[model samples]
Target: MTVPGSAPTPPDPFAPARLGPLTLRNRVIKSATFEGVTPEGLVTDELIAYHRRPAAGGVGMTTVAYCAVSPEGRTERHQIWMRPEAVPGLRRLTDAVHREGAAVSAQIGHAGPVADARSNRLPALAPGRFLSPLGMRMTRAATAEDIARVIRAHAAAARIAVESGFDAVEMHFGHNYLASSFLSRRLNHRDDAYGGSLANRAEVALGIARAVRDEVGDTIAVTAKLNMDDGVPGGFWLDESLQVARRLQEEGTVDALELTAGSSLLNPMYLFRGEAPLSEFAAVFPRPMRLGIRLAGRRFLHAYPYEEAFLLPSARQFRAALSLPLILLGGITRRATVERAMAEGFEYVAMARALLREPDLVNRMAEDRDVRSLCIHCNKCMPTIYTGTHCPLVGPLAGPPAPPLTGDGGRPRPHAS
Candidate 1:
């Protein structure tokens, strides 16, 4: 039944694949979902155990989530920020994952408008002055000095990643973080070199990426999580995002691009389809903010019906536009979906909630092609980032009983990636 001279099939999802200088054992990457175990901004035994399970189960790469370049860049004070003192702990984390035959990537970025300034005791930065609901204050607009410093911080973070034994560094340029905010026409209303035209707006992201690549050279693979769309009105759309993708390819700034959507600042639920846990979210905030959430949470946490490979439709656009390797994210939970992604030219697939639901999901799928994930997409896990990110249905896995549910939502922690 072979057709003569026909093109060969794409590589199997479970087979090895090259990413920059590193060859991952498979094409599945555990996308960065902020692990809430770090209470002191350093790696803890819990955090190590959190990633170790997924690595031991089966994933090409397990990403350490939202490691800020600077303390203020963190979404919450307890989040990890690259520092000399942190290297040893990070080394231990990387070693544990590597021992399981999986590569580990550190996701680095500034939270920008997403930062809970109140908790961090530092002002959040944005392209323009804007209101930060979490902090209940206005964000500070970035100056030229702040911009330069942030770009340099990204390079420094990559250097730390190399020292810490991370095989790859995923620069966070999506989710309405500092760089992403600059890319948004609605969020960025500035008249400087870092704003205005799309080219100008992209300077922050481009500078950081190039700096990271230059800092690490070929010592570590460089990847970016980019937004194909911001999923908000008057925001960065697919058309403009493709242009940015082309520029990144033209400059060879990244080895691969992981396409994602949704703005953590405006619409967090757009990226994660299913029920929005409004009550759980409101429980985590202060009473006044809790009231505010009851009034406006629905607008921010809009729900979309769950479906396998929900992001594929938009990701297909990027796949057609560039020859650069692309990682398709969002709603990837089945082996068939992985096959579909590879068959359609995507070099890799990234999963978050499904893996949180079952760290061994990938290994299970590898054993049986007919296997489907157990994640129901309830979104209950969304609020657990404060205590520990885990499926509430499996209470024991998340670590530490999240204190008795008080009338004010059981002592909520700060919001983060």
Candidate 2:
């Protein structure tokens, strides 16, 4: 599993590593980069082909981006819907990746208030009524019954992952989504058992994890993409996140944790700042792009351009606090960075934009030790995703429309025109 042309003195990046119950061939992971490749909430040929390229490229595992448990909770127009009928296409996707010697995982979640019901024509549910950053008014607090339904949906989705030949299921518990929104004091204003105290705030995430574990048992891996800091005042921070991680680990509800940051509502730029123009995105944001950019010069932002592995420090800190396997994600794009993460105690390193830039990056890295990625961190890939298009920076192969998954067991038909 050693990368092909790398120096013999350099350690093999593709060697086997344990992730929960599954042992991956390497520490190189194709992180969840949204491809907008799933058409009509089903696994399309384009999605399968896009994922298989990475598997063939040599990543130990590939994670499908953002599978919605319920249609009302989707993040995009073409997000995969975890339903009984969608399992066959998902199985095909996983099988394709597996044939290339890489394991596959599905990221499952509910978008909650972050989604635009006006666009999807679905009801946006949250813990409380709040004005969304997009200027939409979120209505209706999640009732106890609603909470139960969401939890069941997560469990059902996990079951589908198992049946669909997925080796793992990564729970979306970050980025101000359903579970993350509940953990935020500014978002969850309810006085019930599901809100207020830290324990109460974590109840929904804990319940979702428990349900997924119960449904999937010990065979398939259960991982969570957790936000250590939402990068906003009064939002979920490291101390509380660490506590939640510890509790979940003790409960045996999650096998690994992928550390991420920022609330999409308060700071969408933080998650994908590279995509937006410096002036345009920052002007709309509450905080300054840099603390002293006004006093200093523009040289500061240019010096430290947000690239892959930007969240390594947070990942390292979490690794120090817990013995659970940690997957370092963010702007990981180079071999040196990947090696550094492993040396710094991260069990695995995941890449999104880099993979989007070149689906065969793993293979390229394997065949040529000196190969550097072409993903300039321009983040042109982000906006097109909303319209169900591939990355724009990826040349002709990029931006291809997702091929439809036909047959009755394919994707759910689109409700909108």
Candidate 3:
């Protein structure tokens, strides 16, 4: 049943709720963000620690970010790949999270044309050929055979996700990745069966959903992170996304929809607003890209003002349109915004930067009932993914903190509130 639009008694964000086949302790989910801990696509102690800390801190579910279905599908070589050998390490990670009282999920996806050839050392694939800004090379338009293989690869990865003891799996259908690239009319220029009209572009997404559902069945819940708007003028917008959402709902493949916006390829700042750390971002790249950033840094690291519940305005349109539960992502910091999200009919709130800033922010809120996040939304944490994902003001990943945090192995600050 859908949560009513009319405020149905503001819910305690801490209360447990049902999400598909699983029941979460709360409506809070850790939105997937790249963890630069793994090397060679294998889970390391640091990788497990990264997720395990949040799980222990308190989240309904913690999603391991941007796991590739195949090796070449990865954005970087260190990103986890779904395979038999990967299962054991993943199992260990999931077991750790589960022990922390939070269910774990895997964000499975293909970087496609977003794959960095310079970093991952692999040619990028997309719905149509184009020059890649990151890869610095011409991308290969996926052949029909390649498309079929990628679809199957996602299904095969779902099976591994289940084997690895994940409570749920989220297909990454946003951020101009493989499936999202197809949705963007600006990106997908092919006239084949998989391109041109909106329906054709949507086929690959639906196919992936059905294929993954078939593999996982009722054993684990299936979720999708879909774009509400690509945030680029010519990209996939809300009107088209609503149709895709309705289709996914009708197809019975996805149990919940996590709505996000912006294209990592086009308008990245659309996804994470606030101060755009241009020089910090430029530092991560090689000399060639660094030189390019020095010339066009402002355009590349576009700035958007930060606001709590930043996605609520756009996501509410979806809440009125679809009955399937919606998970709102973006700028979810303080308890007020979370309550606001629930009051507005959003079933769950997914947080990224807030959680990164305070891994135990949920627990801190639970204790104080009024604790607020300290994330300034400088967006410097974004470039940290190239080396390590951490907040500049918090944690061991970014150096000494002004005042240490309480959870995720940081020194306790009982007076944090």
Candidate 4:
């Protein structure tokens, strides 16, 4: 994808870079921020239009945020299910981004225990039977058959992603999802091969990665968003995650790694740090959840001070230990930070909220290096994902009252940072 006679590259951030089979125009990627625009697990014009602005603005690539591998894996009823039927709408999204000079990637994943039973109208699945405080339901433990089904679902999603014109597929292994849950000692209590040791716990994730590579070959790039820490007391952490990344590198299942931390079910606030929109969240949910949220929302949506390139410290850990290219996420709002990342050996930086606030931020940065994003880090945007992921601070996705979550993929992607 090429921008039409665009201005010359800046010293660092604007340099052309190649990730796997895709050659990007620059180092910035519009990271996967779940756009709750899909109404029936189908893509909408609003979703397509939502990404085009960033593509035109100047991001080297834009990820079509989390797409479930199966209906059972969706976090909500309206999320796109990665099946043959989803190909047409997905193609439309990819086509739109490509036209604006950006490569497109689909973040494919299974929400696993993070799946909501009340919203999905289906029993949630987990490594072991447990009750989710978030979904407020008794979840089902995945049987051997269920395990096999999810693995195959990931491969099928990758094949469909290629058919739908995606240049890359991001395997979602972070945020306490199916693969991540297996890694959690507190979650995976299975006596079977898929659960005992750390290596065994990671078996499900490794299998899915291999299966995806076996299906897609080099037709598209495979990236994995792996967790460095689960942010819970007894959850997955960096030491174990580094070992997993090494195994993936040896197996050659992924092309790049995007590091993330947090548990969608527990310690949810770890992903995007700033103010916790407790009042906003309470207002968005049903009457049943409103009371529960009002009483304990503070713990669920805890706040952390925002710092530019807040994740660099974690990402640098992966860069020092691995040879594969890495994409730094979280608090990447300025060009100087992007330059710091590049100089430090990180190949790219992924932006979610900043891009949401200003789709043209990349273009503005290219024209003027000192440009700073207007995002306040208030995190009011978190609740808005359900209403179609707009930035309330400014821009089109902002200001529209957050409706309900109506909020809200894969690879052998071993991740770091």
Candidate 5:
């Protein structure tokens, strides 16, 4: 039988694995990929259907991408928010994915200074005033009061996620977001107890994790998407990340840690990799082609030219330090890579781009031993999502597009006209 991607499907990749207290049917996990299907930060039918495909595809677990804990600190206004009003739709999403027999995780976070002020119309807050690599000047530094508010926001979001029927919540502690900003000396230039020293720099993350753990208790699994390195000169490097990871484990605030790298703001190309067709705003501040080419030269620079199980080595380093379950992400598109990751000490292997190319890939890989995933790692899907474009690679098999939102008076209405 031919698989969806037309590559030889490998033998059953669905061997059981464990994440926290939950026992998964297989080692495969559909990593978080932002689809922009949710409307006004609320779960919609399109979002449910988008996730259901992967659940039915036989992955052990699938993580919903980038739910904002604070509306003012969000990347997109249409991104899901874990508020009381959003709980019902989120409950429906959980129920639908559960029926397909796959566990689900919701990734919760705040964008901090990375949030687009013009788009969201909200003031951005960061650890300290600094220039964004994107060229936007940071407006303000987060105060003690602001820190308290954001910490509570995370806890509140975690509570809502658990109450809404999510089986797990993954904290976004990477990619130069709030937690990562505080952890990196390059970004956090404060003299307070929350910065200056390594221990101080990690205080915010530790506080947020503790609050989430306290609010959710032992009911829902809590994992963190952590950056192994920020991939910039004088950025958050492996040594500091290891220290922070050890501290988090000691505090008993996290169940699993997924190692990732690169700062989305400082190194967008590195984070997503490849040419992202310029959107209106992205074009407003374009980097010179020569600078882009220079950044792309480093082997670890961009996300393109994917290699299987790319993050395993860093994960292995972390494994030697902590006994917590480790999740290895990046470029895992085949069964052999998955097996190799597990053998190298990764408790779980997460695939984002690969699964986007073929949502039914896990099932096909499970059914035959010759199937290879079809993802070209072109990174086209990354930018297309901002424009509300569905994954062209999988959209045919997935379904029709939902109504497009109109450009009506700053309100999100279906694109009509």
Candidate 6:
């Protein structure tokens, strides 16, 4: 009898590990699930509390999600964009997480076609013109000048992250964002140097990674969340993605690669395999958009069955193809899975929904080797991104919406901010 992909006694998942220049307490990282608490494109006390809970709960590192590289790169107006004005608040957030004894990383990227043009009041750029259902408009095809600007923006974002005291910066190259858009043959129809061939298409992602590394120079560990597959027919699939991963490994700019899947543009649910919360998602948008979602949500949010370590099979390909450190994401729910990832040679394991369901789960897992996560994979938390991201099955955020607190010594103030 043979244990599949078995190796020598696996390193303890709870042991300290080095990621580039920083030493993390353990091998587990809290994957970035866009915290919707930053309503003014700046940090809020709510945002700090959101990250603090997981750090205190015992993640080796807690990632602050979707810090856009520029104003126009944001998915919507409320998302945080890296800027000098944003640093002080980010500094406070980093400090809070540091007090919990966990390193913090900022996940930065340009949303591109994923950007909501109506809410951002700015044109969203894509590799080629495409109809954006979320913004109800056609995305503008990115120009050469626009590409240069976005590349510079990534470097600037990394500098800001360093100044704000982030221990790591995970460049977002997944989920059909700006760089990921260029990688897709189905989306990038341009005849320019930045399109057609895989190498040309990869120029954007490679350039951004090099620029970011040049700007920060190991001051903070640089990692990238890269798509292993886009999950759309004729999109960026494994064959091309393996080559892209090889190039990233060759460049040696990123310290580690966190492998992910799904297209935020065409197939958002592929990344998080489980029940698609269609009704909950529809409830968050305006009536017109809600109607659209009700009509078409199933097509976009196609459900995939839940399983333990869902991405491990694909991640194993990367592990086999490249020597760069790999973070296995998707369906990481229990201590056994983390151990499984380690046994298979993955450097770290990242979790989002599980930590959201029970913030103290890592600590609990440390105490009990057989511990399992409480997340039911219902994904009701998916729709909460528009309001405040929380698992509806647990804690204060659960149940019916509470009435807003009154101002003026508990008397209802007619015009409260």
Best by TM-score: 1
lDDT of 2 by residue, 28-52 (tens): 8877766666666788887887788
Q: After the best TM-score superposition of candidate 3, give how far the Cα of residue 269 lies from its true spot, in angstroms.
A: 0.9
lDDT top scorer: 1
Q: Which stretches of candidate 2 lie over 4 Å from their true place?
A: 1-12, 278-304, 386-389, 396-399, 402-417
Error in Å for residue 387 of model 6: 1.8
Candidate 1 structure quality by residue, lDDT tens digits, 250-273:
988899999999888888888898
Cα-lDDT of candidate 4: 0.82
RMSD of 6: 5.7
Write one digit per residue (lDDT tens) for candidate 6, span 89-166: 999999999999999999999998888777777888999888976566689999999999999999999999999999
**lDDT per residue (tens digit) for residues 194-297 in model 5:** 98989999988899999999998888889998889887788899899999999888989998988888787666554554444333223322355335435443
- Using alpha carbons, what is the TM-score of model 1? 0.95
For each candidate in turn, the TM-score is 0.95, 0.85, 0.92, 0.92, 0.86, 0.93
Which whole-number lDDT from 0 to 100 does residue 18 have in model 5?
Answer: 63
Residue pairs in clash, model 4: 108-409, 109-409, 170-410, 171-410, 171-411, 209-412, 386-407, 390-397, 391-397, 391-398
Candidate 3 residues 125-228, lDDT tens each?
89888897756677889998988999999999999999999999999998888899999999999898999999999988998999999999999999999999
Those runs of model 3 whose alpha carbons end farther than 4 Å from true positions after fitting are: 1-7, 286-291, 397-417
lDDT, model 1: 0.88
Which digits, one per residue and each the tens of the lDDT, describe model 4 over residues 168-197?
999988988889999999898999988889
